[model samples]
Target chain A: MQRLFAIIGDPVKQARSPDVFNALAAERGVDAIMLSLHVGAEDFAGVLDGLSGVRNFEGAVVTIPHKRAAFLQCGSHGRAAEAAGVANVVRKTGDGLHGDLFDGFGMVNALRRAGVEPDGRSTLVVGAGGAGVAVAFALAEAGAAPIQVRDRDTDRCRQLVHQLTQSGYPACEFADDFQGLRLVVNCTPLGLDPADPLPVAPERLDPDCVVADAVMAGRATRLTAAASARGHAVVPGEEMLAGQMPAIWSFFGLPGETDISAAKR
Target chain B: MQRLFAIIGDPVKQARSPDVFNALAAERGVDAIMLSLHVGAEDFAGVLDGLSGVRNFEGAVVTIPHKRAAFLQCGSHGRAAEAAGVANVVRKTGDGLHGDLFDGFGMVNALRRAGVEPDGRSTLVVGAGGAGVAVAFALAEAGAAPIQVRDRDTDRCRQLVHQLTQSGYPACEFADDFQGLRLVVNCTPLGLDPADPLPVAPERLDPDCVVADAVMAGRATRLTAAASARGHAVVPGEEMLAGQMPAIWSFFGLPGETDISAAKR
Candidate 1:
């Protein structure tokens, strides 16, 4: 029997997920298919109920807006989802829906693939939103030491630092400055627009640091470009996107096998 | 900003929706993305509620197991969705999820493109499920007369007849035989398997009849193959799929604006 699958979200036009998963499915020789679905905030409840009763479909990935909403829907969630209060993947089980957040793993995978070790490293993260929380958790999960969390919302920083420490990340502190860090990550939407200001000044960045930005739309962010000029190894958002697929595939009970180099070719 | 979308279903991996919609989105110069989401039956309600709050996604396409569920989830349904008791498209409205069934339009569009006029024409449809309901409605919408509906479950046929008549169709009746019909449509899954029996006896099919099957997976069913041998004009499931895209796009408020053909190339 053929297995069916779909992604649910509104404004579903800009996602690269179809190309990404379709290619992976074809390579795996699974008789499964994926599609784009549009659902608005008001109708999300009905659509979710409608989808579960449908016989053929097997899996789904929850995107923004829905991620936090999904955290409450699933019967249970992973630790990351609990801490971050968002879920990016929901797996269908015989009993109920099982949800887990993979955004943090995506970042970890990206950094590992780039030969950057967060363990025994001092890292600074910008932004305290969903992406920032995931990135901080990932850095902690990978054994980053003495992590500093920063955000325009100082309260958010304090809250995240508390959560990070509780989650067993190394000693955490609140810092508004970018100094003496082996790595830096920007998770806010600040760099998405061309006119957006730099999350951090270039002069404060360590030339030997590895800089990463969670913003994905265009070529390079002002932050990453400046980091590149400083001779720092920079990781692109696409790298994180590519890195996340394997773990996501695994979470969905898929084969979870993908060769990033081969895919790029 | 790039738009995001998802197809919500259980067996999401098997859907071809992502390929079709993403291709169209690319051709239309719309910065949109689509993905497949898999949610289970039990968690449908929670998941739907969660999705409604997502900020980036605009719309989604609903499929099997979810169509009827989607119908109930809609804050409001169009005349078509209300009549069919199902929905294939759910768009986010300012108020809530607004649903409309496009399968009927797809059937009508396919027939019109193939130069098959249903007005005052005699047609026999061999299924009473969702696809059959849509086709029956489309035939009525096309002004067909004396449309015959048949299903293995006699009650379903009677109920569908009642539904169709109430929805303003012209004289729908139940017929078990395929004799003296100008057009024959197999809306059931009977002919999907290559080894399955023809939905109707070939000898009973008119030589000049229009035969159409909603199956797209493999070669033509025995009925269509035999009908073709006898010089009948055959409509494949692909035609219905192609026919539906324009209307589906239109439902998303994209309409003829999406360049589907160019994207596929």
Candidate 2:
């Protein structure tokens, strides 16, 4: 049977998951395609209810504002989703809809792919929003110690730090500076506009530090470009997206990356 | 913005609308794809409600057991849908979801395309089910006089004949045989199994009569093949489906056939 998947968000035209997953499905000869469904916040519950009735609707990549709503709607959640209080991926199982948070895993996996193991590394996660929270928890789970979180919203930043500490990652704290950080990830939207300043000054960071930007753009963001210019190992937002594809694909119980590659041959 | 469309039915895997509409959308650069949604009768209402909430969901091709349900759910209907009390297509409008039946028009159009104008022709429609009713009404509307409808279920057959008569198609009546019929259409599931007998005896019909089958098969239906073997004009089920594409596309307010060609160039 041909299965259906969707990447659902309010303004869904900007989503790349449909293209990525659909291409992978086609290449692997999987009888499935991921579509971009533009569903608003108000319609989320109804849409979710409706999609559940579709027998072949196997999974969905929840994006943007729907992630939190998706997390709330799931009957069960993975540890990553529970820790982040949000879900970016959802799959239908015999037990019902299962949700998981993959943003942090994606970032961590991307770093690892770049030969920067997050385990035992000092990391700074900028922005206390959904992405930052997810990344911080993921890194913590990966054994990264002394995780520092920063955001313009002091209460939000403090809340994340508090959550981390309460969750037993006692090394987590609120950061005021970039000192001694080996892995610095900007989870803010600062680099979306060319006129915006870099989330953090690359000059203040050590040359060996891995600097990553979460703001996806057509080309390198200002922070990524500056970090690259400073000779620091730079990971753009696309890497995080690319890193999550296999994770999400596996979460859906479709073929894994290795299986897909084998199938391709 | 990209739009979404779906063909909804219980066993939707066999539906060709997705391939047909998706191909048309791609050829016209419409930034849309039609997916097959398998929703059982029990889930139809919830699914329809969910689909309506989708901001980019422009329309759906209703198939099988859901056509009448779609009709009942629609806020408004076109004349064909009203006449048939069923809808094969539904489109979103500012007023709400509007539905229309194109099966009848499709059959008539297919016949016209094959150089057999239905106007003033005496036609016999086998089976008084959804497809039969739709085709009979469409043929009547196309000026095919003295429409004769037949079915094993005498009650159902008489009910359809009554509906046509009540709707001012007084020339319509219950059919007992192929006598005096200039055109004959098989609207039942008779041809689905190769072992099943033909819906009508092709030898009993006039040599100049036209034959059409609504049973979609991998190859020609027995009735159509036998009729064609006897030198009668025959229209296969695929032609009915092909004929409806432009009508359904136009109903959705998408680019028309001529406009699509112009855009393609």
- Candidate topping lDDT: 2
Compared with the true structure, what per-residue lDDT tens digits does model 2 show for residues B22-137?
77887778888788898999999899899888889999988777889999999999987887788989998887789999898788877877889999998888998888988988
Model 2 TM: 0.84
Off by over 4 Å in 2: A113-120, A128-130, A141-145, A151-170, A188-209, A215-234, A256-265, B113-120, B151-170, B188-210, B215-234, B256-265
lDDT of 1 by residue, B66-148 (tens): 77787888899887888778887787788988888877776666777788887887888888887788888888878887788
DockQ metric, candidate 2: 0.73
Model 2, residue A10: C-alpha shift (Å): 2.6
True contacts kept of 2: 0.83
Candidate 1 Cα deviation (angstroms), residue A62: 5.0
- Residue A29 of model 1 has an lDDT of 86
Clashing pairs in 2: none
Reference-based TM-score of each model: 0.63, 0.84
The native-contact fractions of the candidates, in order shown, are: 0.12, 0.83
Which tens-of-lDDT digit does each residue in A1-265 have in candidate 2?
A: 5889888886666667777787778777899888878899999989988999999998898876788899999999998788778898999888779999888877887787788898888888899888888888888999888888888898988999998889899555555566778989998878777999878888889777899877766488899888888899988876676678777888898874633222111
Worst 10 residues of 1 chain B by lDDT: B256-265
